[model samples]
Target: MELRHLRYFVAVAAERSMSRAAEQLHLTQPSLSRQIRQLEQELGVVLFERTTTGTALTPGGAAFYHHARLLLRLAEASREAAHSAGEATREVVDLGIPPGLSPDWVVRLLGLLRDEVGRASVLITEANSAEQLRMVREGRLDLGLVHERPLQALTGTRLFSQPFGLAVRPDHPLAARTECTLRELHGLRILAHGREQVQAAHDALIVAAHERGVTPLWRFAQFSEHARSCAEATESDAVVLTENSARRLLPQWPWLRLAEDSVDLTTWLIWQPATRTVVTRVAEVISGLAEPVTVPR
Candidate 1:
């Protein structure tokens, strides 16, 4: 009827003597005997037979002993499993990253996270900023790196800012210049990422080029791989990208900063407001890694 009843029944059946079981259980002989009698009554079965030598099991007592021992073992195993579950020490954090980002930066961030959160595992997914923002809003991703602050109910922090630069083939005339103005890129065919892939950055470049009175014929591709293929096939005059990404993604080409100071690119770290503590800690590490560096013009 109860766990204690099963335990008492098993102990009494094992020792075959009321006094011995009582001594082992730290219960009075009368108390232990009464408990065993109550168990037999509840089951309507005779268990132990009184004997002049020592108590002996009746036919029913032998059968009950087998199941009673199993029940006690199962209960102990269940308790241990529950306690282990409550003390779980590891956590997994899912992070989304934009494509064409600097690999070196990502490696450094991952290393820092591993060191700081020893019990945390990181899962990385590559997606564009706009897509990453949508995934974070939908609760599919715990954190993301995006080009602009998300307009959704999520929280965001600025990670770092980079200047826009031109990537061109080695033989291109612009490759020889250390820097060039947006206005000077006019009349040249250029390869650019699609508006949907990086909405904020793409729109900003378009608006800045328009304000500078430059209207290059722009060829748009939806993904970084496609944009790179287009640039190689068409031998386009140049492709625009952040200085860090340009150097890592297309190292064969030369990267030249845009002479216009206003053409800066910024990256933000975004996550759901209810993100786990591990994700928040990782965000802090990223913010610390974003300190500015001075580069001579």
Candidate 2:
């Protein structure tokens, strides 16, 4: 019925003498005998044939011997395996990253984590903020880096803020400006991502225009790929993100420019108690790298 009973039975069955088994198991003979009697009672079958020479297994005892031995060995093996996995898990940390985050930040975060934790084995996943948040909650991810406003249910530490602006080809007239007002390009096409946030961004820009007594024309690009495609297309005065996204694409696409005026964005790192140590170390590394870099005001 219980593991201890199985242990006592296996020991007695292997030794074949209650006296010898008790000596080996460090128990009194009567105590061992009582345990065997209890085990037989629970199973409703006699296990041992008592003889003047020694104890022998009954027919039922022989059959149960094989199964009980296997069960005991399997239980031991499971405990060992679980212990090994737990040891490895203690040294590993998994992180979930937002899909649109720059590869540079991802690489930086991983390198920092490895150096900080030494034995850290990192697993990385790329998903949207919503998906990453869910993964963190479900314990599939230890932490996440995202740009959405922090949910009340989830605690987060803000990392950095970036401005939103138009990305354009170098040949575009707006690209040559040292600085320009929103009204200068009142009727130009625009590209942007996000559903509600993009709309919010648009409204903010429109409000900026209204403050300057001008109206700007725009269209929404729901994904980064679409925004990039619009930027590469000819006659594309497409609205574009003026955020730090440009910094990420600069190495590969060196011709994108920040449009005159746009909103700014902030990013955060989110995690729960289980990931506190790793996240704190990571935040320290990010903070060190995030030194006061100058940006357009």
Candidate 3:
């Protein structure tokens, strides 16, 4: 019935343990349990199934969990909107950027934000696509640059599409090649960003390599610098990176385009539909920078 009850339920659903949720909520276990029981009694349905391991959501609980999260998000957004309206002296926008994004794009975005947003200050956070999506949905970030399309009901503007490529050290045999086939990557030690960080790109690479009968030893890292270091230390034959990232991070090395025609690397500018005016202007500036390119992948 109350917002606090919804918050408690959400916390319990997330943590899956009464004690842990109580600790997170800063409430005693008994009090939290009592509140949950009151909520279930009011709703006339069981929410959580008690077990030795922890708590598991019942069917009713799972449905309620989804709606509870949405309600909480809407409440937070309302508060933020009111706060922003009250403070007319200055504006602040929170933006999220994924790792290994092209430096040039970041520079352009920052320049546009400064020019269009006037005196508004922008806070930048480095996060993966999934993390950015969550932040945007939870009202923590006003905008995000992500590699994958969001599954949620958020607005995403398509940016330029990047072509996939392989980055090889100058000493590597493949470095001299203008283009490399996925089949040629077999038996090579490869490095790339982890799937959790860039799920779509990583999945595309895996599928393309598998189709070509190539299964290179994959070493994954969260950051491009770490991937590069691992590749150098292990004498990796190549690192799978976008053409733009390779040019920026490893220009000294040779970047060979992948011959696979099915792989596409695209970046999207994502934000909630009800974003603020300043955030909307920022997104418009980014959208005007480049039209969506159709890479023949």
Candidate 4:
């Protein structure tokens, strides 16, 4: 029998009088009787006993009542669950970020996402610029912060262009200088992230240094903890990285800026053009960030 039959049976059993049950259901008494009769006939069981006092349930009716109520409750729960799933799918946004983004920037982005996007939540995945770009292009990531050159394939906005710097020990001779060119760093061993981490930016800086008739000892490390461990183990005199990374990874040491205009790292925010509106909102917030400044002291 249909759900309406179960409902009619329930109402009649609850009220005990057919006329009162019909009133509550907004159906005429004859219509209500016909519906109840249809349900009993479909089940091939007598669900109610008629008498002068009032209508009452049979033993069979009592048994069916519990099962009918339970079925209605389950149906309602299923509908609510489906609706909630749809809402969650719409509200969650996936974001990819490269390593060494400042904690302040991360916090600011997260806070703004909560306040501005309202019910949206961000799922952050950390990968290098290359991987992040690929993820964004492949539609796996809703938004990405990458260091690679802008592509015609995806929508992008440049957020910061931080010059590279050298982090050296206090006693190092270069520590006294605020900034120096790659040509000036001749013969000194310098550690940096490999091309695997920031392929375009790293390669460009190396090529520029070579073109300037400078060839220094090049040491390669990954990011943060790995770089620190390698610095302690190797004879590399200085660490070459962005100002943000240098300050966080080698705090208390001197940061010497590389004077060559081309010897710097730039970051961009990239996303698919047709992505969810929440992703576009997040991109706008990031693009509004003030360009980072370099401090050499």
Cα lDDT tens digits, model 3, 1-297, are: 999999999999999999999999999999999999999999998999988889999999999999999999999999988888866565788889887776666877788778887756888998889899999999999988888986568998888777778889889889889798888878888888778888998998898788767888887776755656777776777888877778777888899987754466777889999877878887888777655663222
Runs with alpha carbons beyond 4 Å of true place in candidate 2: 1-90, 196-214, 232-235, 247-262, 273-297
lDDT of each: 0.80, 0.67, 0.83, 0.82
Cα RMSD (angstroms) for every candidate in the order listed:
14.0, 12.9, 12.1, 12.9
TM-score, every prediction: 0.66, 0.56, 0.65, 0.66
Q: Estimate, for each residue in 1-297, the C-alpha lDDT of model 4 and write its tens digit.
A: 898888888898899999999999999999999999998899999999988889999999999999999988888899898888856454678888888777777877788878877767889999888888889888988888888876898998877777778888777888999888888878988888889888877888788888888888888877655666787777788988777787777787789887764466777888998887777887887777737643222
Residue 154, model 1: Cα distance from true site in angstroms? 0.9
Clashes within 3 Å, all models in order = 0, 6, 1, 0
The worst-scoring run of ten residues by lDDT in candidate 1 lies at 288-297
Better of 2 and 3 by lDDT: 3
* Tens digit of per-residue lDDT, candidate 1, span 1-297: 999999888887788888999999999999998998899999999999989978888999988888888899999999987887877577878888887677767887788888987767889999888789889998899888887767769888876677777888778898888898888878988888788877777888898888778888887777574556778776688888777667667778898888773465677888888878887887777667664642112
In model 3, the runs with Cα more than 4 Å from the true position are: 1-88, 294-297
Arrange candidates by lDDT, highest first: which order?
3, 4, 1, 2
Better model by lDDT, 1 or 4?
4
The CA lDDT at 84 in model 4 is: 84
Local lDDT at 132 for model 1:
90
